[model samples]
Target: MTEIPAFKKNLPTQIAVLGGGSWATAIIKILSENNVKIKWWLRRKSDVDFIKKYNHNPSYLTDAPLNPRKVRAYHKMHDALNGVEYVILAVPAAFIPDALKNLNRNHFAGKKIVSAIKGMIPEENMLVTDWMEKVFGVPQNMLAAIAGPCHAEEVALEKQSYLTIASPNLQVAQDYANLMSCRYIQANPIGDLYGVEYCAVIKNIIAMACGITHGLGYGDNFQAVMVSNAMQEIKRFLDIVYPDPYRDLHSSGYLGDLLVTAYSQFSRNRTFGNMIGRGYSVKSAQIEMNMVAEGYYAVKSIHQVNKQYDVSMPIIDAVYNILYEKAIPANEIMTLRTFLK
Candidate 1:
């Protein structure tokens, strides 16, 4: 674990948390523990109204408290971001474009931007931080990403969880880390911005792969082998794409995050993959879950991005082939098993 830095206490007094999902509500719950006020932006006016009147999300994490006194819900992006000093984006990666469509670069001028999003921008194959910089003109130094073995469900339970705050600026990472730290959560900082984000994105795909195998009735023995190999695949991809000698793939930021996402019941990617393995069509599984799997989109993005480098990513290939190429999951996994050992 990297030691938490000693910096001037400069926590933002007000923050804008975008998105109306379970993750967004859980973050509002965390921030509600502190003195800082939160301006939460939900896409639907009904959901926003529900939070205001009932002090809890109507769709997700309804059991979690919202505390109307510290948290104010908004339907408009402009109203949510009006006077905030920091912005924490928690929406699904696929909806990010529409979420911020009404705003421009000027909207994020001096605010510290943190991505609670784990998946990359689809089609563009860009990390959220990179996309934010290019589209919103937010500087790299002002940006940070949150990676976790932590799940929103677990956070709502106040279960002990840890998060990695990655940024180009150590102090900036530390600053957000301090804000995110609470009794149930321990936030740490690292400077390997790209490495952390890429691993986070890759892990979802791995989790999907794990789910597919489990749904096929594969035993724990086989699942163990797949996850171990998945870690190696992540290391190779990260080493080639964003080389950092000091980055530890085994740390909580990398391997730990992957493990939880791959195995946890709360992982939507894993749940999505399981449905696929159980013979649900892609569209059907998506409709049943009614939540973004992330891996469903990320597989294609990573596949396209990996075309240039051509890393030996068998697990990723198996997922892409099954999800995109319409390859049989059983056949894909059988072939994938041969390459694992």
Candidate 2:
């Protein structure tokens, strides 16, 4: 663990972190290091009891220390969200509905909601911010999305990581970013919430594709070409969907995120895809990896969303076909090679 930095001059802000995954634990660790008050919600009562008693998450990031004075673990969603100004959504996209089923719009009223989820809603086929806006009635201005190349495993190791907080309201984004920044974490704010979020979702699919190819015994040269083509596909999709003239695909929020997810050893999406490429059935791969790979669900959502825009996303299509349509991984990937330059 890195040295904990001194608290900022202002009073600590009350924030709620939802989910019990590795990412959620990492976020708790970061907030604890910064001396922010955390109300962490986990589904299982046993896990909550363990975290509350031991001052650390028992399942994920067990070695990372948590501040008992500043952090409180809760099994009930209602209790966790109570009196919190900021709420960070770190749960897997597919499980979000079940996790918050007991809560209503009134529970989230006047709160700043930040999505640390990198995937879309599987059932609604909507971005998390969009889903929150429509389902929970969280206004666009109050919703922010976190993007960048940071991984929870590396954060546990105390590696220097950067995060981009995107919201339609820049000032609100900056204020939340302040609570997240610490000795090893640099968080910056941006105004392109939709762009950053859409790109973040798409990058996980691309990472899965990279993993599949690597598992199929494809060399690095081929992966470089595929990733280059993926950038173009992402640009095309973003142009048709969001149409931001000022958005830079080359930034750390976009390109940096895509590259890290595609190649990092810690990427669950890549690991899942690699299993598929190595001849494991989808069910078997999922069983082997107890963790959820966002790309599996994300590729399906992106495929459904792209029906309106009809963007030229060969890589996404290839992944969707393999994962959802039951197309052979080798055949789909081989057919995919013809589409890329």
Candidate 3:
């Protein structure tokens, strides 16, 4: 375990969780366990009413019991943001723009922002931190990212999980980490904000590649090689893009995150890849899953971003080909196998 810095004094006590998905519910469960007060934002009035009445989310993670006394649910963003010092944004990356379309810089003025979103903004191809900073005038010191090998389903079950909180400000990161730590969850604080955030997005795309190969009938041996190569690929990209010499790719924030997403039963990205491997068209697979597989969008956005870096990412190319260019999955994986170390 990494040594945790001493908790900073006088950190924000009031916090709001902004989203209604499984991740958001998992966060609420952790906060509830700690006996913290949370103002939660769900999209619909009916969902808010249901959670308030039943002490459980109606749609996602219904089994995770919430403490209604500790949590208040609201349908409007502004209503949820009221009087909160830190806002944890758990909304899907693709929908973040539209979700905050009603508000401006003033809405976010005095709040510290933590992003639990592990994706790029689809329209801007920007990390959530960059999007928030550029669009809302939030400074880097005020932003933090939560990265994980941890999944919402496992968190809901009270299973042990680890999370890394990355930010440029060590004090702020440590302060937030203390809030998230509990008996079942371990929180680590680090300063590699850009690298960790980029890895969070990159791992989803690589997980999709793993899923595509799995769906194409490849076994564990091939997967082992692919994951190894994927790690090297991630290192290569982050080195060129973020260039931190001390960043450890093997940490839970990076490699562990890749392994879980690549193989976990709850991985929507892997499931999406499996469908494509089993002969489902991209549209058909997406329709069937009824969830946002971040990799489907990440592949395109990352591919475009990589053009400036010109990194050798055959796996990313293969996924982009299969997902966006209509290349057959079997053929793409066969070609991909030749490039893996």
Candidate 4:
């Protein structure tokens, strides 16, 4: 058991981000707006120089320039964690296993760790919080998940966005909500850790459904239907993982997020789905988007877990066929709709 360090007197409000990517840069902009200090740790010196010179990430978020004066970039993770009260992980879900490989779990030191990255590991099929607990021995009470419809592209533009900060601990949720609250960003504290994570995973599949519908030349009617059905499937799946997730189930966070993600032009998950619908292979869609379409990763993970628990997630199954089984997005839907109907 690692003992948490007592905060030193007069330490500034510092949040350390563990990955250097578009979402990280966007959140830094949002956090800076709240007058909080941010230290972003990256693996590359080029990113450091890019932000230092251009006030933006050239690789990930060139369109949304970061103000170098407002945020500091660090090369070493250790330097970033020093004196930081809260830590946010912003890397891709696939990279998490490797990210945790070198991190000093003790350095977390029982700090409030929030997962801004939303996806499940392929092998373990574990949510970010579950992965953290297994690998780092972090407690659920200290873990927070940021999930909702806000996009990095929109957040960078300083648009009005709402999200939920959730954990089993209400104070933990509130602490993140308070820390993340800003002029352009509104955050609501939520209590269901299961619902928050489930929403984060399921929205991508809904986005996939949207992409296929768009490719098939359908209008809002298809989107409306997809969103409704997707939520029902997510609720069913969550019921299997947590038999009583309905106790705190709120569509505002889950369904609202699904709605925006499925329709938003900036959604990588939806765009990735579009590519699959347009005959691009999954590998190629990944290439075109550059960012991990979390739903793509979750398709396999959720499928494996669903089988383990005998939980039926038709939307996840449709996405799995399109992404992994190389089924056309529209054809995949047709294949599933018959049995589902």
What lDDT tens digits, residue by residue, belong to model 1 across residues 10-34?
4537999999998888888887877
lDDT of 3: 0.90
Segments in model 3 whose C-alpha atoms lie over 4 Å from true places: 1-12
Worst 10 residues of 4 by lDDT: 243-252
| C-alpha root-mean-square deviation, candidate 1 | 3.9
Name the candidate, 1 or 3, with the larger TM-score value: 1
Candidate 3 lDDT, 188-255, residue by residue in tens = 99999989999989889988888888888899999999999989989899989899988999989999
lDDT (10s digit) by residue, model 2, range 159-207: 9999999999998899878878999999999999999999999999999
Candidate 1 regions with alpha-carbon error over 4 angstroms: 1-12
Candidate 4 lDDT, 127-207, residue by residue in tens: 888888888888888999998778888887789999888888999899788878888899999888877787788788779
C-alpha TM-score for every candidate: 0.96, 0.96, 0.95, 0.92
User: For every candidate structure, what is the RMSD over all alpha carbons to the true structure, in angstroms?
Assistant: 3.9, 4.4, 4.1, 3.5
Residue 331 of model 4 has an lDDT of 77
